[model samples]
Target: DEEGQPVAAHIPGLPEGAAITEGEVNIDLIPTHKLIWDFRIGDLRKLGWIIQCDRKSAEWVRDRYGEEAYKKLSGKFGGTRTDGETEFEVNILDSLNSVLYEGVGDKQRVVTPTMRSNDDVQLDADKMIDYYEYWHKPTKSNPTGTFGIMLADQIMEYTPYPIDSYPHGELPYIPANPISVQGSTMGGVVRISQARPIQREINRLNSQIDENCDVMGNAIIMVQRGAKVRHSTLDNGAGNLLEYDGKGEFRP
Candidate 1:
């Protein structure tokens, strides 16, 4: 039922659907308890200690050591220490505050580079799906498809064809006749024209490449800007050249 749907009456020790009443019922008296623990650690050192304590039993060490000693201990627990640990603290706090205050009321949320990359990959996926539909147009039920060969061409634009080498690997090409054998269930017949295994693989690989590029590029940009790795994920929200926004949701 939807949020505003009328409440139904439930009888105790009676069979299901025996007596049902339909109308709005007050549910304000429903017992609800929410438990929220304040786990906000403001300082970087404190944050690191919280993370360390969460993973291992280090209460004794934490209690015995001072702030500086605890930070050293925390570093020892990890395999490596960050060089710009001091600057990282300031950046992380600023980033945290920015995220918390984002998209409040009239304020517009600025997309991060990392977010842009994710959107690009999603757009690529959607385009591939469109291409698949185009290739496999005109099924028994629909009889006519909206998509055409143009979509296939667009998909190829993003997917680079590998150059042939001395030890030549099989050269890949988009199938001219992608769909065949309709209404036949016995054999592995393509339901749609563009539903070929090779095409699907190509689309998958293209998506992976786009995602990797976005992530790697965003990470480099974040490091260059002297932001902490913790806040680097925010880079995804940066502006993207590609106009792909997956389902129109700005995900990080």
Candidate 2:
């Protein structure tokens, strides 16, 4: 079982509720925001670790694992609710696909997946449970190329990271920029740094141009001293021409 509970004492060949259906398989894609992983300095298989988080409803967990798992997962506030259908978090850890390194006290435990028999046997579709197995890279220790499950990090489940094929067993994430200052690392350029200065200069120049145009664009007329000037003739935009009769200089 997913919770590490024993389903049955003894089994003949395949475990009970193990799905072996031979039809189109359904795959659930997880979002990237919920994923956490170490820096991809080089090859993905050599990286330290990777984690996938999944949000599940209380009813969904109860239906999949059982009532005991639901009670344990949901926090104190969850228990008070009349309806037992709140969302909860679960994490899946995939380390190098084959080897799962778990730290226990001072020592670490390297867990490998268990192998299944090759002989054909009858499969009961009615009692089958839906699950997916990840592709494993064949190593010296684990040459069988199989992935397994382990429990660690409070309640995080250890499983294989899903990939399309063995040739390109890369992590599911893609960085925005391929070029990085550090040759081994991956990142993109900081576009904001270049754009912000140019934007500020453009705004400053526009303000200066507007101030100069405003002073020179207005209309000003000159009138001689002691000469009578009619205010009605200066009506805004009335297009009345003014007549100045003074012989010397005029005041504007």
Candidate 3:
């Protein structure tokens, strides 16, 4: 039987209270070509690659002009409105029709649309690349393009670099040290103190505490020895607390 297929009947020798359970089987139809195509187009656009044209026209253009040219034209013609933003259909169809039938019988002729002359030129892949390169290093007449190129370059350069390249390392275990002490026994009271060298040290300590200790445990304190103590108090009774007392020592 297949891995997840259920048996027709359970075996009889099993324990009385035990029950046989079948594994769940999940099945789904593969996505259709239309769905895949739409998803791919959306993905490409999100990655700065443009895709446009209705399904039929897109297919025709891709077949005739090549995919590269079609993609370039899509970006170049982005946000253009040809039919009141509802449809891209244009009256240029009449011109194309006229150009096709202009030749009579017994005459061989070729007709091509005068797109550039009519201001209908679509910037294909080659043109877009050329434009970008030229914009980056422009001639005297193309100062505006040069300015735009400089601005784009500066913006990209100045943007904060992503921290993804930094490798994550396991934190080293830090031994806890005392920050303060308050007690009085036979000899006298001794107070100690210390602090984290930096904020990141504190963060590391907190992270370690969270990982190793129970939620309701004694608070872990870290202190450095020979740390200078500023002040202290005695048990239950008031006494003069020394400020910068010579008894406490400061270490680098």
lDDT of each: 0.30, 0.40, 0.30
lDDT tens digits by residue: candidate 1, 41-127? 332221111110011223333453445544444333421122211233432344344353347786866443222223333322122
Error of 3 at 109 (Å): 11
The residue ranges of model 3 lying beyond 4 angstroms of the native Cα positions read 1-40, 51-86, 89-95, 106-252
lDDT tens per residue, model 2, 154-194: 34243443322322333333434234356532223333433
Each model's TM-score, in the order given? 0.13, 0.28, 0.15
Backbone clashes under 3 angstroms, per model: 18, 0, 3
Ordered by TM-score, highest first, the candidates read 2, 3, 1
Query: Per-residue CA lDDT of candidate 3, range 82-178, in tens?
Result: 2222222232343353364436876745475444333245433222110111111111232111212111111112211111221111111112323
| Collision pairs in model 2 | none
TM-score for candidate 1, residues paired by index: 0.13
Over 4 Å off in model 1, which ranges? 1-183, 187-233, 236-252
- Cα lDDT, model 2, residue 202: 97
